[model samples]
Target: MPKLETRLTRTFNLQYPILSAPMAFAAGGRLAAAVSRKGGLGIIGGGYGDPAWLEEQFALAQGVPVGVGFITWSLRKSPSMLTDVLKHRPVAVMLSFGDPRPFVDEIRAAGARIICQCQNMGHIMDAADIGADVIVAQGSEAGGHGAVRGTMTLVPEAADYIRATAPDSILVAAGGIADGRGLAAALMLGAEGVLMGTRFWASSDSLVHDGHRAALLEADGDGTIRTQVADIARQIAWPIEFTARIRQNAFTRRWHGHEDALRKEAATVGPIYRKGFAEGDAEQTGVFFGEAAGLIHSIESVDTLIEQINQQALDCLAGPATRLTSDRP
Candidate 1:
């Protein structure tokens, strides 16, 4: 594989400029460790903050250097979770879906890099203001919760903002990025690296259910829809601006546009949604994934996935120069 180095790699001492999104419930210790072992950074999803689950995942990492990510708004409910997790000495701590300022000082004091996932220019500015070590420009095309803005435009905009403001902060692109093509495109868009979710969610190392994995393989970009139905059904109480991009299923079909109705019926429907998710009923529950689902066809180990993505990105980055030279002759 060709060498692909960037500020992110240098700052993190990583061999690849790739980081796995800390997808809630799915990105566990095994997956994060596998990615770290494979040269990329893996982030265990700390999702709604079950202290026991978080501890268990960390144990699964077994001392490998890995980070942990959390839904920022959710993290507010359990401030102590951050203090507790800091004890494990994570390489980094990623915050998304809410203001990161409150916890920035603490994360920094703990000697861990602070990564803030931003959904728009406003969010980017806020992250920069808080002195985030890394800022991920998360587009709406990403799986899980995010606001409007496409990756292509958002990344460059964030890059410009960071250059003019927080020069020390590393910019990473996320959403609709599944393979080497996306990685190459991200770098060209002025980001130092890429943050992937759906691709890794489908990998063998991930804690994804078999049913969800099968659905992901069969899905196309069009199969995903950004909707509040999943959160509503699960009673997560995400902010108004954010919506989750998940595979459209029977449950979504019935509630996508009828969020108010779903909310009203949460007492009745919430249990069903939770049951479906627990049972791995693909059609009945939300299969959280992004537009990149179309790009994934198989479930491979994290090692194979990262190796292929790195090589392919290097090839893609070099293709234009090779073709231009050939044409000039």
Candidate 2:
């Protein structure tokens, strides 16, 4: 057995330590089910806690043991929404971008594991205080709404923090993790596994447009830019401290520097944004991706991508240090 397989076989209840990050709009039933069926943990991005959309995706899952993830602060608006989702009995409840303390009891009472996504040590400690079963350290390289800390530093920092204070807690690294190299590096950085978004968003199962997937396949890391204007235009209020990483297009280029103006124009631009999504225009719509876009060459099936990553990780782990040379002996 390869060392990677041995090390990553059961990081959690998952057969593979790989996890598909809950990307709103892009990651839906097909993507989540595909990853879950392929031995990794899949999570439906319950973005803003839309019960209808979540219910539709749950039906689409068709018996796949998947969980649901939500934007924490957004869920705060409707506290009862959590209770509603809990009725479905998700494997876990993933909360990000806010204090997770308020809903911990409800999630626990429902017999669901709690996975908290954090941007820094402060939030990680807070999640630990809330008794999170798993803590996901989402670095700045991630797509969607994210903080400004880079993955290279955040993973190890989080790992060290947990080891010293809450050694029992499991840590997963997010942001810019696309390939086996990234996975191997994350493990080396002391993460038990990785939460991948950009890589999977380019996969065939993802709900994103073919043109968007194609663009992701061709884009290098430098092609992505982080901005808050898109969310503002959509009236998706996010904390000022966090920004969304998206493909830099004409719309982003125009508004990235002028958030106030974008807010003023949001009423008119909101419909335009939705229309752009329908029309598949990059300039008008937004495509989310992290720095890992540089590693994407083509969009493959979710299972194939998982296998490729797993094999690469195995090869990396079973290197010279673990190899036993029978011929030399």
Candidate 3:
């Protein structure tokens, strides 16, 4: 009913400048298709390059035009997975947490737009240097793995850098953006759109465990902390510079400040962690989300959530001008 168009909308041919983040193990085919069907682009998370899982999710999308995202560093271990995904003719390919340059040519050759998710100015410059079609400025407030920069400062700075260097590359904002207020703020900060993770992770269509979703609803912004505990427990070997943000629980309380200790006990703890994760034990497993957890109170369908956000953003954008008058003192 309400529309706000920007470079991102035009470039992606979408009704709204919204893209659902490809959260690992959570954003699945159903979630991706739901977002896409609602006029926003959705990306299935191809975390750690599981060929079988990727194929299954693609099949579940049921012919909907959706994209796929990968943990770039993990993708390096099985570069052939990219080749396989390209065969599906994904509308876009998103690379995050590693150098996207190595796979740029192949993605472009496949006729899919390239979206590089960058954590800092260097990453932004690198993405632009390689002629990325879309650049997402992802801040530390984002769920899962990310570097230390905050979204507020990183986004406008990224916008300026992209404009001066690669004018054709459009910018999107990520990290702690869950609702229409955040979408409106991103537009003001020079982002053409917002790429959301935690919000979508809580959507009914997402693949998050019921316990994890329950934890998300109960969490406030302060309840989350950045740590290496989950990665250590899962033995993910993420780059040292990036840490994951997850809800603080008994597991984190015990392991957050003791990385070496966690490593020492990983053999004993890892299996327990895996079991907890599989069983949806929120206290023992990592409830991955961001500060936006505080903003989200309910789990709704992707289409309903998108429609509400779009209309709320339109209202917020128009309200400031209408409520302000020269006669006001």
Per-candidate TM equals 0.96, 0.93, 0.97
CA lDDT for candidate 3: 0.92
lDDT of each: 0.91, 0.84, 0.92
The number of clashing residue pairs in each candidate reads: 0, 0, 0
The local distance difference test score of model 2 is: 0.84
What tens digits encode model 1's per-residue C-alpha lDDT throughout 190-306?
999999999999999999999899999888889999998998888888899998999988988999889889889999998988888888899888999999988888888999888
TM-score of 3: 0.97
Candidate 2, 97: how far from true, in Å? 0.4
List the candidates ranked by TM-score, beginning with the highest: 3, 1, 2
| Better lDDT candidate (1, 3) | 3
Q: What TM-score should be assigned to candidate 2?
A: 0.93
| Residue pairs of candidate 2 with colliding backbone atoms | none
Q: Which ten residues in a row have the lowest lDDT in candidate 2?
A: 320-329
